[model samples]
Target: MTASEPGTPRTGPHRAELDLDGVRDEPTFLDRCARDLALPQWFGHNWDALDDCLRDLSWWGRPSGYEIRIRGWQRFRAAAPETARTAADVLADAIEYWAPRDTPLTVTFDDQE
Candidate 1:
């Protein structure tokens, strides 16, 4: 469940962080994700769109290997628990879509406040 301990990076998967603090809503959450993930200009800012960009990772110019570590999620959850839960589910589905390809993208969520 944790992605690479806390502060160290091995010469393995490319790592990214998405901070969920103050993300209380879908639009802001998507915006933060796009900024953090370096998503494309044509990013639709929706669940399916996020899935597509995450699967491709073409915008960031990094391919195949990625570990997206999400933090501060409890702040968002405290503000809107349902929204946070739904977003997590959507992202998990996206990761699942790419996993079987052998170019698996891992998304690990930290619920600590």
Candidate 2:
């Protein structure tokens, strides 16, 4: 059964309610990257660094047609020692900036289930 089917226990904590209409028509991975880059400089500027950290731990990305969800704390701790603390702090701040005080921002795939 589908995730929305009645009695299907939710597998994840936060539900990312993505509205395709709200997403761009010409959506692509690059478009998503660009939008992510528009976040606060502190967080956006470190995207590559954060990605490298996650890559090193085999935590980022997935095979085509699949989706992956990463925990912020896990990614934070995986960063290089010198940058880990700062990365975690910046991530916390960015999360607060992007989400409402009552709700959290949960990243999810836009093009796949």
Candidate 3:
């Protein structure tokens, strides 16, 4: 089970090839998350917010960050749908509030040494 691009119609194979930097992985983040969490597969509509959060912070390598955030958010939402909704609302508001800031946002992972 995999989440197709949000709002994009899916037909054909249950799995689709993700054109990553170059490598093709068998199970995409959406696929694995749906399988592991047993949630109705749905592409995250808030992908852009998640992507910006990741890129600004430079967490995992870009590829890994995409996978982690997508999967993590899916799992989170599945576990607590209400909380997820609240989080999404907060994130949206934050983006609007922060948009006018002149300084670039920076995110750092403490785990990185």
Whole-structure CA lDDT of model 1:
0.76
Q: How high is the CA lDDT of each candidate model?
A: 0.76, 0.34, 0.35
The better candidate by lDDT, 1 or 2, is 1
User: Each model's TM-score, in the order given?
Assistant: 0.77, 0.27, 0.31
Query: Which lDDT tens digits does candidate 1 get at residues 21-53?
Result: 778898999999889877889899998897778
Model 1 CA lDDT for position 113 = 62
Pairs with backbone N, CA or C atoms under 3 Å apart (clashes), candidate 2:
none
What TM-score number comes out for model 2? 0.27
Q: Model 2: runs farther than 4 Å from truth?
A: 1-68, 71-79, 101-104, 107-113
Evaluation by TM-score, superior candidate among 2 and 3: 3
* Residue 88 of model 2, lDDT score: 42
Task: Kindly state the number of residue pairs that clash in model 3.
Answer: 1
For model 1, name the residue pairs that clash. none
**For residues 1-113, what per-residue lDDT tens digits would candidate 3 score against the true structure?**
22234565533312212222211222343344234323332324244444344234222212211221222454445555665565455445544544454322222112211
